[model samples]
Target: MTGTPEQVDYQQLAAEIMERCEVLGRISADPDHLVRVHLTAEHKIAANQVEEWMKRAGLQTWTDAAGNVCGRNEFGRGSAPALLLGSHIDTVPDAGKYDGPLGVLLAIAVAELINNSGSGLDVPLELVAFSDEEGTRFGNGLSGSYALAGAFEPAWWDYTDADGITFRQAAIDYGLDPDKVNEAARRADELVGYLEAHIEQGPLLEDADLALGVVSSIATGTRHTVTITGQAGHAGGTPYDRRHDALVGASELVVGIEQICSTGGTIGTVGRLQVYPGGVNVIPGRVEFSLDLRAETSPQREAALAEIEAAAAEIAGHRGLGWEIEQFYTSHETACAPWLQGAIAAGIRATGQSEAPMIWSRAGHDGMAIDKITDIAMLFIRCAGGISHAPQESVTVEDVALALEAYEEAVRRSAAAAVAR
Candidate 1:
């Protein structure tokens, strides 16, 4: 009993999405700023709001043990395998309103629209608003999705926040039973696949004059903390050829990293740096910095990292300095499921666009963690100028409308594919 595409009130849905984003934006821990981290009062508030909305959408909603808000529309087939849709809900400090919330709200809006249209999906549908994807509090991103994927690490229970709150204690304070956290893990047989609709968070679609694109893959990379150590000496006494200047060595390594990444397929960034013995007349004796290296594939990223490491060692040796690099984080690239990609492409074509663009997401996403367990696919909605993670991050109502249309179609197509299989 599904209705025609024109029967969908996309304009009203867009307005509602905007209104809800504003509402959640107001539910931040910082009354004067937008910072809602995991297991905090603001996180619980936002999850409650989303739970109410899910219930209103004719869904059986609940907050998972990991604090993720979830809803499911079984459509008469109880406990059936479902197509999962969602994105994370937590935000970084002083973050924009839409990054994570947009996808979750869009999924709920699609559900409400279908319910109102007197139509039903051929397959079960489940929506999740993941609780902690930004990892602002614990330095461990994708906690919600990782738990859902049955990948939660026990060591994380002891992880502490900036306020010295342990992850387990924070969960308890948020009114969740930390002992039952393992119950949040979903078995592999529980889902058909996962689909997430998120902002492009980049300039590719806008530059191409398009409103949406299907993601081909998520980026893979390595992260490290690098330290270069040398001898400190008076600035006047340190000779150009005889002195071991750690800051100079670090500066050279930064330039070398840029050169390595500039070869065109990788991205390298030195986001943080610190120098020891800060003084006007003292040469820096020790320097520490951060490196975020990324590429579309593991091999490519590893190659770039190897080149950077070799260069670092060579430069440190030439400068007569001691150097060490401690690798902290690494994630392999995740490619979208082929059939899911086909479904997304079909959905894009339904919007009067003969050519649906494909792009790789340079930014990390929950899909990174979820992909470890289930097939994951993502739709990228165009933003104004490809900016994200900042207050200026924005998307138009029209763009959201298009995103909704494509998202719904993709869901329907995925349902059909599931039935066929």
Candidate 2:
């Protein structure tokens, strides 16, 4: 258990990390596909497994009030502020294994390597396997990290899953007290910073032919549910000109959203849609759809949303439909800490990259919530085809090996910077 960073076996570490990801992948609600959700039996099993790994890695491990699996390596520095590392353990429906769990495993791997090296940092290290990030079950993502950042909203307790299970009841079922979730919050003064190593989840790193990259910022994202109401009648009885079909009106708005968002350089998606009186012969009376909008800045995102709203209003008026939009979630653009970005760059450089590529994340992450408590940065590993959240998502062992090296070095650099400060 004594070796320098150079002596560390990254290939072995990467292989083990991947194997562990596969192990976690099998603990899913669906046997045919990976489908782990927060506060479910599958989630509990994964958390327990993660805690076991953390303990074996020489970390004092426990499950937080929010159900986050956490481990701390004080390095004998009693009560010192810690450098936190982790990512979510939850997954989307039919998800790929690595999207969330890879980051957690990598953090644990780094902690093990550091512990085995017999060299400790000035700042203590803590690893968290966040209970929920995808919000696959409740539709309110980042709940675990939000609790840790002291941003947990009581209103969320009322949120229900597809099966009508309230988040509060789910927490109780998961053995967490709904009223004491606040205990998960960590004081800002008690944390040096947060670092997460995640797959690029986009083609940027792979396109650039790089093994790793440093995230500059996470995109501003907002989600809304739009509903349109109109007359429902027999499809054959509804004349094209006289019909006030809600589905047709919503279709116009969806197209408008795509056009406006595209022109404004924003990303927009209408991922969910429901039509009432769903009979093939019926002219839909009501339509509900979800809009997920994202951009590099708030102004850009807002501009696109404004344009979309106008379009929806116009479409509703012209089609004689009633329309309403309710914004459900928003995560503003979060810039990585400059100092931490430098440390991440240094870490990438340590992996034989003369220059570390910088990129922006369009996907939301646990860091968005953690940023409320402390500065945060991310290291991105290249993933094949820039695909994620699906079975097609893939990453190479070589890139993971590089990511492990780079992430560990980033932690070391961050620790050095903390000491200097």
Give TM-scores for every candidate, taking all chains together and pairing residue i with residue i.
Answer: 0.96, 0.96
Residues 1-421 of candidate 1: C-alpha lDDT, one tens digit per residue: 1234667667667878988999998998888878999998888889999999998888898889999999999887688789999998899999999999999999998887766666678888999999999888999999999999989998899999988999999999998888888899998788888999999899999999999899999999789999999988999986888799999999999999999999959999999999999787999999999999989999989899889989999999899999988999888999999889889889888877777888999989998888877788999998889989888889989878778888888999998898787
**Candidate no. 1 TM-score:** 0.96
Per-residue lDDT tens digits for candidate 2, residues 132-181, read 99988888899999999999999999999998989999999989999999
The CA-based lDDT of model 2 is what? 0.92
Worst 10 residues of 2 by lDDT: 1-10
List candidate 2 segments past 4 Å from native.
1-3
lDDT of each: 0.89, 0.92
